[model samples]
Target: MTLPQALQYLGTAVFAVSAVLAAGRKGLDLLGVLVIALITATGGGTVRDLLLDRTPFWFTDTGYVVTILLSGCATVVLLRWRHPSERVLQIADALGLALFSISGARIAEAAGLPGLIVVVLATITGTFGGVLRDVMCNDIPLLLRPGTIYGTAVIAGATLYVLLQSVGVPRDTAAYAGMVVIAGLRLAAIARNISLPALTIRDTDAD
Candidate 1:
């Protein structure tokens, strides 16, 4: 498989495993866990395909479904032996985000989209799945969390991919570089407890 295709499969598996782990935290049954895992694995790419007026990728490739199912089941079995910490979930999620962000940007660029749209689509493809998963789990979506750098990391990676392409960097090299940046930024933030300043609204006294 080409690098982008391989990354897409890897991203899907990582997302599925992470979702399975999260469902365990929620005490979900196997069926519920698989459902969440499937959604988390494919939601972002499905949305991106719709926006691009293409067939949803998983619809075309049964491999994605198989990958999600196998990864989810494997994670369920692994969890039976060793419980995962939230930090583990975060790390898996960061890697999946990095993979999907660059892959999405590459897809958009191949479609002849503008740089802005490529970056936007990349961010959506990186984060929307997690958003859906979190909403289903009754947790605030990481992208919506004011202090998190989740979305920013995706955007930064997507922008870098676009810039590198503009400068005539090879597509594969740019994609790998973008993935590294996204994963590095996210992992660093998680390790350092780094966060964007939260915006607050305050009422002023009427004078």
Candidate 2:
């Protein structure tokens, strides 16, 4: 398979596994695990596709469904056998976000959308799934959380990818570079505890 296609499968699996682990933290049953896994694996892509007016890929791509199911079950088994560090899940999520962002940008570029739309699509693809996952689990969505740099990383990487592609850089090379941009930015933020400054609204006297 081509690099992008391979990343798609691997990213989907990683997301599915991460969702399974998250459900375990909630003491969910088997069905609950599967639901979370499927939602996390497919949510972003569905939104991206809908916004792009394209068919949702998971419906047409059987591999995505299979990977989600197998990865979910396998993750449960692995966690039961031995606990893995939370870092593993974080790294997996980073990789997934990187892959999805680039892929989403490519789709928008191919669809002849404006560069701004491309960036928006990429951010949605990278983050919307995790947002849904967190909401379903009754946790603060990562996109709303401080210190994550989640959507910013995706936007930065996607804008770079679109610019590179616009200048006739190769698709694969641009995509690879885009992934690095996101993963590097996100991991660095996590390591350094960096985040955008929070905004507070205060009432002022009308004097």
Candidate 3:
């Protein structure tokens, strides 16, 4: 597989695993977990393709579906036998977000979109799957939550990818660099408990 394809598979696997874990946390059955995993693995890419007027990649490539299925099944089996730590899931999720964001930007650029549009599309492609998964599970979407740095990491990666490409860097190298930056930043944020400032509500004085 090419670098972009490889990154896509990696991202899909990571998201599938995360979806299985999330579903399991809610006491979902195997079928429910598998369904969520599949959706989480491909929902963003499907949306991206639809918006770009292209056929969904997963629908065209059976390997993508197979990869997610295997990953989700393996995750369920592993979790059933031995529970994985939350840290492991978090790290995997960060890496997946980085890979998806970089690949999304590259795909948008290849489709001849402007840099700003590429970044926005890339962010959507990176995070929307998780958003859907969260909503399905009745939790606040990570992208919209105060404690989550998910969407911020995606935006950073997409912006960096666009900048590097504009500067004439090779596409693969630029994408890889952007992915590394995003994953690193996400991991750091998790480790240090970095969070956006919370909205504060103030009581009005008597008028």
Q: Which RMSD does model 1 reach against the true structure? A: 2.5
- In terms of lDDT, the poorest run of 10 residues in model 2 is 198-207
Q: What is the C-alpha local distance difference test score of candidate 3?
A: 0.86
Model 1 compared with the native: what TM-score?
0.91
Model 3, 1-207: lDDT tens digits are 897678678889989998888888899888999999988989888889999999998877899899999988888778758988889888988988888877778788889999999999888888889888999999998889997677888788778888887789888788888888889888998999999987987968875
C-alpha lDDT of all candidate models, in order:
0.89, 0.89, 0.86
> Candidate 1, residues 83-181: lDDT per residue as tens digits?
778787788788889988887888888899999999999998998988999999999997989767889999988899899989999988888899989
lDDT tens per residue, model 2, 1-207:
887689889999999988898888899999899999999989998998988788899888799999999989988888777987878778878988898888888888889989998899899888888889999999998888877798989989998898898899998898889999999899888888899998886869786
Model 2: what TM-score?
A: 0.92
For model 1 the local lDDT of residue 134 reads: 96
* Ranked candidates (TM-score, high to low): 2, 3, 1
Q: In model 3, which regions exceed 4 Å deviation? A: 201-207
Cα shift from native, residue 62, model 3 (Å)? 0.8
Model 3 worst lDDT window (10 residues): 2-11
